[model samples]
Target: MAQTEQRAAPAAPAGHSVTAVAARMRELRASWPPADGVAVFNNVYLTVTEEVGRNIGRRRFPDRRGAATLDAVFAERYLAAVDAVAAGRRPPACWRPLFQYRHHPGVRPLQFALAGINAHIGHDLALAVTDACRLLDCEPAALEGDFHRVGDILERLEERIREELMPGPDLLEIVDPLTHLIGSWSLERAREAAWSAARILWGLRELPGLAEEFRDGMDASAGLVGRYLLTPLR
Candidate 1:
């Protein structure tokens, strides 16, 4: 598949609103070929963001503003990475694997989808929670409800993603490496760890040096997991 250039929309004055974020995702989905790893991930994430937006509109969250704020901030991290790659700059470690292997023919679409999820949920979610707290002038505890609600949405979507993307038995053997690889990571577990990391990051806010170090470590760790998830199965 030929790679298409993906340009991110300008950041909103207050950061990207959910609507703007969704629009940018839609643009990427349209511009990139379906087989492109980033587009594969973009489609799944777009569905997740759209669903979250609907839930927020229906007042499903106790703190609607907080949920929206968290959702937007979380999305901005991914978008920032995309923007970086588009501009020929290096993205964060957590996002590098997907961009680097996006065109690899040996990797399956399912791996592409999960790799993106691993980077976003494992790395971006924690930082987003902290960012949202700072923007809302609240603590991580205040956003806990919103955090879980968003996570609940992601958990549900992950099930659907697996069902929709998993290869048939004819295409994948029982002992395939992809099977074991997929089984190794769990979105639910990732969410739990993300929540813990968010609280830790919030605590480290008072120590900039320690906080940056922790953030860098988290990014690199998630990127390593992403690389594992994208391991070619063919």
Candidate 2:
């Protein structure tokens, strides 16, 4: 994804408040048509975030504050990605493909949801982890437990997506492109990369230039996968 106009700010400053990110996402869903790719992904993400919020309220995680902070910061990154796109500032590499193909009628809702998830998890997640650390004044190691809990929720949500969105059994041929796409991309793999990236970012926190370079590379690589995921099969 080539950079176009520069954003007024990079995807929500490092510590931008996340208090309204979920609500903003909900608003986006309401504002767009149901078939809109961004709206489709927004709806799914909103549900996951809402669930996380509810669980946080219930004190489900061992580290309640960490969980809340992680969830909030995590959401902020996605919202920022959208903001970047809206400003025509060239959203992160992972997200550019989704925004570009958002209104393409040939893309399925499931594809939209998956591409968004891929971008968010593969790219935003590591950065979000760093954001949480900055806000909480803690180390990434301290947030590992919270990260795992959130990852668990994401995994379950992915399973639900498959159950609800996959085509009927009769149409589920092994050669289907969607099937191949799903099988090729692993959320677990993304989660692992996020952890490693978080640690790397933390280690390079003092070297802002180097850290930004790593982030850009990650974004571009993830975006490439997203583009592949969004390939128009029809």
TM-score (all chains, Cα) for each model = 0.92, 0.89
Pairs with backbone N, CA or C atoms under 3 Å apart (clashes), candidate 1: none
User: lDDT of all the models against the reference?
Assistant: 0.88, 0.82
- lDDT tens readout by residue for model 2, 121-220: 9899998899888877899999898799889998999899877877667437887887887788889999999999999999999999999999999999
Question: What's the distance in Å from true for residue 110, model 2?
Answer: 1.1
The CA lDDT at 183 in model 2 is: 81
Off by over 4 Å in 2: 1-19
Which portions of model 1 show Cα errors greater than 4 Å? 1-13, 171-173
**Which numbered prediction scores highest in TM-score against the true structure?**
1
Q: What is the lDDT of residue 41 in candidate 1?
A: 98
Residue-wise C-alpha lDDT for candidate 1, range 106-138, written one tens digit per residue: 899999999999999889999999888888889
Candidate 1 global CA lDDT score: 0.88
What RMSD does model 2 have?
8.4
Q: What is the overall TM-score of model 1 with all chains considered together? A: 0.92
